[model samples]
Target chain A: MITTDLVPPRKGSTMQFGIFSVSDITRDPTTDHTPSEAERIKAAVAIATKAEEVGLDVFAIGEHHNPPFFSSAPTTLLAYIAAQTKNLVLSTATTLITTNDPVRIAEEYAMLQHLAGGRMDLMLGRGNTAPVYPWFGQDIRQSLPLGLENYNLLHRLWREDVVDWEGKFRTPLQGFTSTPRPLDDVPPFVWHGSIRTPEIAEQAAYYGDGFFANHIFWPKEHFMRLIRFYRQRYAHYGHGTEDQAIVGLGGQAFIAKNSQDAYTQFRPYFNEAPVYGHGPRLEDFAEQTPLSVGSPQEVIDKTLTFREHFGDYQRQLWLIDHAGLPLGTVLDQLELLGGEVVPVLRKEMAARRKAGVPDAPTHASRVKDKYGDAEPRQPRPNANRGDNVTGGSPYQDTDEGVRASLPEL
Target chain B: MSDTAPGPAPVRRELRLAVVSAGASDPSSTRMLADRTVAAAGRLAAAEGITLRVDVVELRELAQEITTAMTSQFLGEGLNAAVETLRTADGIVASTPVYKAGPSGLFSAFFQILDNDLLIAKPVVLAATAGTARHALVVDEQMRPVFAYLRTMTMPTSLFASTEDWTDPALSKRIERAARELVLQMDSGFERRVREESWGSYQHSFGSAGGTETGIELDSDLMRLAAGGQA
Candidate 1:
């Protein structure tokens, strides 16, 4: 009989550990009244750079279109961060495919890929607000269709040499190519983000793309069901076994030496969070949602439990900055996560994923192998030109006035 | 009033076309595509006997200022003014190149920083140029939905040209045709506006109190639910 004790310890899992900061220029309730937007933006860059310094694998910045929130362009910020740091993969917490045209999205990201040396990826979503549609001259009724069509176009834009597409929402294209080719000639891996929509999950599965469940607010069971659906669909698509399908998850947590301290420190910030405030009790949220509140060990244990539900997946992104938490507190949380929680979690996950575990998506993995080694083909010698194409002399003049140039012939 | 000075007639209905190029260089493919689209609009306006004011805004030059404006209250005023012009324009031709697998973050950032109500019901023509024949679908995949979400009346014909297409005369003709079709649609909308104006007095007499004919009622709950699901 199979014994429960025989289950291996989770350790050595190569996870793409990331920290996301939603930069909003707000007042520091403690001492400083308010900070300038530039300061907030600068702080975001600092935080991302710090995350890398602290050994985090990835750093994602969010996109927002309103006042107070400073980061409207996550990739732009990522590019700047890319210039400042090395080794850390840059990603977007959210990219609104519904409101932005696919063409511009393609060009900008390709540019970013060149800027970042192919260390970029994105999570596409229909943004969170309705007011944004009219602001962009769009109708919300077409959200799903838009997402579907836009992603379809984006996929073709990346993988193919030419694309011919016609759709209901946007104009038709005959043959188009996005420029500033990606570094290493490999497109960035995409993680389709969703909370409740099984449609997005199915989309991810159908395309063999990674499905990311940003479980910030919901219970594990809800995320499990969605992930299960994606896994099953992924198998149905003939990509691999259910466990082999790539999955990424988003988590939020605050930790202190003790549970009580964690709650006390995080409560004030939780209460004022623009997205999650006034909804649930802090303790209850900790219990029901993915918001782990306690010591580093507890955070590790909670994260390890994710494999039990979703199996060995690809990435895990955490929200360290939310609810206008002060920079000091936020940094403290990151230090705890990076120094303590992540090390243990990495060990545990690696041990658990001992066999039949799919590797996390990477730039090296995505590049076409044949193209990887081939030197760039040089242009053929010009037949029309008797000498140089620029009208320069074809050969060096010899000292002999007897036309020594013909000596070799 | 002097007998020689006739009373000022009602101002002629002027059509404003804002052509925003989200490309880098002045003669970049996106800009070229945008120019062709604006030229089409001008032709339609001339044909319709209406004065068309074309404003070509290159996003590259304004990208940094717009990002700065998104945060600073004072700088935001300038961005808002530009946004206001986009809102009031009769038509817009938005062009960009596909970068990665989606729209450029620069373009996306511009969209991300704009207020959602700015582009409601305005007509938009989407166009993109890329390096290879690939990424032709980015117009539909990345951009159209964004326009749709903004509640803009997007023209159905998007013009996507690759590097080869840019160099080919046949592709240029195709782009011109697509631009002409978009202009035709905008001109038709203009005609509808004129027809509506002729009957406006009688329609206005019967106020909303007499009928339950409310304007578009958006389902915020559904949108929220969708957002949650997508997020």
Candidate 2:
């Protein structure tokens, strides 16, 4: 059984600050050298460790199934990072909900939670790459229903000891108990990430889960409308008032001691940035979107405005490590961010934050919520049943009602 | 016309008309065709005691921004304003100069980038100007289908003018007919009525239609599924 002593103390502040990387292995525009896959992967590990050393609270990595991106296996990297840090909340920027089997997600993430001693959470997204869907044997056309249904099954698998589920996208499962059940029997918190899909926001709100807006590319007015709708629906579902809904936003910045040096150093990389390279002028993009490339003070000022636009959000993550900046540059970014920007922004955000808004969810908080001062149930299997099909009480402490409902082989 | 004692001025209904011209030159016939059509439409609206709030989107002025938006998905201020005009316009006059054998790439690319739901049920008059009459079919054959796919109610009289055709009287007649059709469609308030009444029936992406489609239908199948109801 897991005890209450294992849970960490609740954080003093409500907001969490961190950086997330897409793990893209690109040619450094200035040097014209591309890091090998091994080198990029190691660099990512270093970045995460540096994030913790610099006192950032969270670190997230994205997942992609194509070339130019190296984070196809985020949980593996996050688990490794989790072992190296004690306080950093390791997470995925987004885990594809449409293609991967929900059953595997339940098992893999639960295992990761146990390995990390409960310092993990996840965000779900329907990946936009059309070819990746087919590679994973899913139809992109049914992505909406597929994502929604998969999350439903995954939710039950984590909470319920036994799951008998049937859904359109995958074959039905009977008598499935995802192994290594969630650490202390407390499921990891989930945040649904969406760029422009209201259905995703509705799903997140329905479950009282967090909603993460991809607040980087498009105009704020678009994200503002989407987040407002999510907040309204979150209240409609009886989760909490609109202000209490858990919210996270994405942003990107490049910082130096002075604004001019920051701009001059980052312009070449910005001009050739992935997905939006050679498009809008850097000045126009910075003015229109959440991308801030300037002094530390400038980055902080721009980031602080997020509170006014998105209300009091719980988590704010920036994409600072992409665009093939050398690892040393990225490390310097961490130094400036942790040493200068975040300290002031944290105080400012706390001062501006309203009363009664909840802090960002963490594993320890979830465990405390479930068991309070009581010991969390750690299930132990009953002496092996001859063949593994027939289900009686699988665990010693299995509830009588649950045991009685188990299916016979 | 005889002046009479103006007592309690008539409440002239206001209609938004968007004129999108792809003419790249100052003395281009494409803009001329669009202007003639807009003037004729104005006269018809005047006959019906209506006022047209014209919003002209010259594709040439927005060429660089359009390409940028296409590549980066970042809608610059000019492109955003253009989309806003298209989103709220009651009627549209899409004028383009034919290049090679098709409508100008600038013209087609501009419409292609707009959200599909932005133009639904809106009336449009398709007009094209080409160097030779041989390219006259580009308007009806190539451009009409794009608007059709966007669900626009294109007018029956498509206006086309080549160098020689612009000098003929029939071109003006065609423009006048197209204008009358657009005015008739706009005066019926069809686009406004359809959007106001049955918008939920049509599929819309999140923040689509210039961030105006924000209403979440709680009873939609996707919403039900999102709430954990069965597929």
Candidate 3:
């Protein structure tokens, strides 16, 4: 049976590293073979499971409501993966904070947390796909406002038992309660993912949330400015020092025993990937981005440069599966990464990390902080008091009295 | 080319002027008008003891890159250089030929690729050359609003010349007035200082390919709302 509260104090290395997939089901341009949606879905699960087998820290899946992508329902997939894996933390490349109702996000992710034993975390992103807005009965013009207001509501829902939220985008909630009060009464850690917008950075810092910069195909300089803004704002808000602010970065690489073989094997997939194909040459793309197409040691040399560029980040997630690279190739790449790259990086980063920098947050560390020397609250629902979470209070212990007794503000 | 001798007292920064011309054809009068306006501004700068550096972006040359930028949603290096130059320039001399009773698509598209803050509060001398006087309103009615929306410090006097006005003495006087106003703004460093001092208050553009990061204003309405203040 899956353990419900098995999130032990973070045991392994200082840094948390893993792989995130965009869930694109592309035809292998070199072999002209395409995987069915069913096949792609199964392959993704296998890849995530292999992350645990290889002893990685995290596995994240991106959400897209359109075709050529299969990860529309992230929580469902992650819940299933939760049953399958023992130690790997399941997350999203980003949950669409703009279109998805914050109430639904709070409930669903919290539900996943209970099932996953507090081994769940999610990144929030304003998905750049413009058309997804209207389909969800939202206007693209109000994306920023909707995103901010939704998150504000979502934040309150997880922390407070009886939430009365009145925002511009959604209907007013009167004593509404999000169920399955987070596992161990610990809200999952959130990382705000952004590529270009500084307002998003400001929002992340204002909430004292982690800011993730996905350095997929862009130059390092592009993300550096945004990360710097986030770090400065994080400190400005008194969320510890700038170095203690939570950060995560995304990178991709293909590696082999020999550097030339690694480059040769990945060149075909790089040339025909859907997003970046036909734009620039592979060498140009590699030089401009964090992508490395060389030996495992070379990938380390390139990734270590990230600390030089963006200071002392906490999490590093890579894109190891996409562009129709088959499952075998992907598992091999994972093996090389887990065996070679991450082990050395852990030691190097630990030595260089300064006096007070915080490690990546986990359920255990957060719980320990919240309930030091005392038993943490595990909220059980009071008897269903006839329809309206009657008394408007749903939680068992705190504010056990009705809605009228709930404190204002 | 090593400089062994002591240099003159250094100034805060060199005045940078960018000339953007939107004429489609070679040896077009639109480019000539821009050149004249820049020359007048340069003379005024020298009179005030400011060393000036000039960069010109002929839209005729970058016509394709701007269009590609719209679809690619990214600026190529060539176009990025032009946008960066305008972003950091202390002053601008903009001239365009009127097409179909308005500014040319090539001219407007170039500006479209530039970030909204690329020319924020920079002193600008607006000049235009057209086939007839009937199209002179293109400068005041159309181009004025475009620069206004960008929040640039457009000179009080704008220079508009017809094909025939190229020889008119009135055009020369107008160019002098506009150029003198632009140079006045530059020499006083009014726009530059305002931009630097109030930069944190300006809404930044999306991409980092152009523009600098001025910290966001904590008291701004957007920041207040993002901080959970009431709508």
Candidate 4:
């Protein structure tokens, strides 16, 4: 836990600025044109690459099981995006912790982490879709339990080489080892993303994970109290000072060189988009929440207030590219975002941030924090044994006698 | 009479009565029924030496905000203020127009946004206004169960005033009877005591994101299963 007064303890991740997509395949209401699923998926790739090209810090996508959203397999998509980019840290707006088995999640994301060369992290969320619960062999009534139980199991699987877990939502595992292991013996950082669930905030604080407020839709007052609660709880659990509790926030903005053009261009998309279209007028929503539709200076003025309200947050992500504004327009947005908004924000947030506030987290910083100039652990296997399905440690690094239970079986 | 006459002046305890009127028009019969019920309740509470303060939440005025609440999944400033009024009340007088075999859409919409446990154990006087006497049963059948779902103590003497009943002397008596029941519950302090002694037992929407607090105990065998040893 070494640190400088000015810089965060970790390097290259003082605070992150990025974009998150709902991965909406929306028809452009103004133009009356829609992108095919293939085109939209390709556009998502283009958007992420453009993010890195323009010098943004992170590129996160959402996972949805139903239509009108095309990002069902986020690990695969992020893995693909990871191969194409160099330093842009890719992540998820959320990976569903409720439906998918925790074992599969641990294995899949760990594989992606290794492939990405420690350039990944993810957020966990209980999906909002009710019908989708049953589609994944789950009951919506048990969603709260599913989320908590699954996340607990996932947390243990990464840190412990041999996991003995028993939970209600999934089958009991006596001795299981998730394959590939986390990159350099470090799990990708996790942020618990929630809108208003205090229990989710409590959960994040309990485990000392980051708590992310999806601040785009609701008023800032709602989230301010919630973040305050999380910070207090984090201190209660002995994580750090209330100021040291890692926090990330979501925002929505559409900026142009001129403020009027930004407003005019984003209005139709706001009027017909599925998540919040046709509900409140743009001006009212912007006034109430963190949404800013104006010049980069306007976005800067509004985003600076976030620190004043919530106190030195670790990350700020914008929801910029849903509602089918088309690829060309979205790319132009990334340009303004990287070229204008983020530079000022990084400097201002650093100036506003006090000492001992942890960085948003990256794989390298986490590995450094865990090992600290010590050689990182890369777990080895005794043999290519099929015994991991049965019991005992498949990993050589564990004290559970690697492949000893296997030879007898 | 003005306080100089009395040896020691009596302290007036304020009883908040939330009045929800789901009328769409300015001079609406539904609003008229709600106001009449409030007037009766206020008079009865005053007779028993309690001051009644009625807070009106007109559903017509909140149609757009309700739609915004539906999409955004949180109440705006105006709508949150309205809900906060309902939460602090000792009793409620809910009146709605009968529309196509049930309560009007606006009436149901407003209630839908309230946290289910918000009105728990509070007494309510259910009233409805309609064009024909046939829709009189809508009060007991529709509105009663709606309040029942929130675990409110909905009064047995629900008032349903059709166009004819407005002038018929019978409906006025029914309104008084309903109001008397509400006032009696308030005087007994059933909601007040529960809210005071065991307010933590009442769940909230923010305990989880928009999850129901329908007075149904959420902790179960699943807690052990979900969090394992941690639970």
The numbered model that scores best in TM-score is 2
Clashing pairs in 4: none
Q: Per-residue lDDT for A233-284 in model 1, tens only?
A: 7898798899888899888889898878998888877766665555455665
lDDT of 3 by residue, A1-409 (tens): 1112222223435679899999999988788999999999999899999988877899999999999999999999999999999889999998999999998999999999999998889999988888999999998888877887788888888898888768888988877778878888889999999887777788889889899999876657778888988999899999988888899999998989988898789889987887776555567567767887887778888888899999998899999898989988999999988777777677667667888888888887788878987888988777865653545666657675545343344
DockQ score for candidate 1 = 0.01
Q: Candidate 3: lDDT of A27? A: 88
Task: Judging by lDDT against the true structure, name the best candidate.
Answer: 2
Comparing candidate 2 with candidate 4, which one achieves the higher TM-score? 2
TM-score of each: 0.57, 0.94, 0.81, 0.88
Candidate order (DockQ): 2, 4, 3, 1
Candidates 2 and 3 compared by DockQ, better number = 2
> Candidate 1 falls in which docking quality class?
incorrect
lDDT of each: 0.69, 0.87, 0.81, 0.82
DockQ winner, 2 or 4:
2
Candidate numbers, best TM-score first, in rank order: 2, 4, 3, 1
- Choose the strongest candidate by DockQ: 2
Error of 2 at A315 (Å): 0.5
- Sort the candidates on lDDT, descending order: 2, 4, 3, 1
The worst-scoring run of ten residues by lDDT in candidate 3 chain B lies at: B1-10
Q: How close to the true structure is residue A339 of candidate 2, measured as C-alpha lDDT?
A: 76
How does residue A99 of candidate 2 score in lDDT? 90
Candidate 2 per-residue lDDT, tens place, B134-165, comes to: 99899999999999999999999999999999
Candidate 4 per-residue lDDT over residues A1-409, each given as its tens digit: 1111232122366899899998989898878998899999999999999999888888999999999899999999999999999988889989999988899999999999999998889999999899999999999887887898888899988888777666666887755778878999898889999886666777788888999999887667678877987898789889899999999999989999888898899999988877678788888777787898998888888998989999998888999988888899999999998888787777777877898888878887888899999999877777654533534656565675543222334
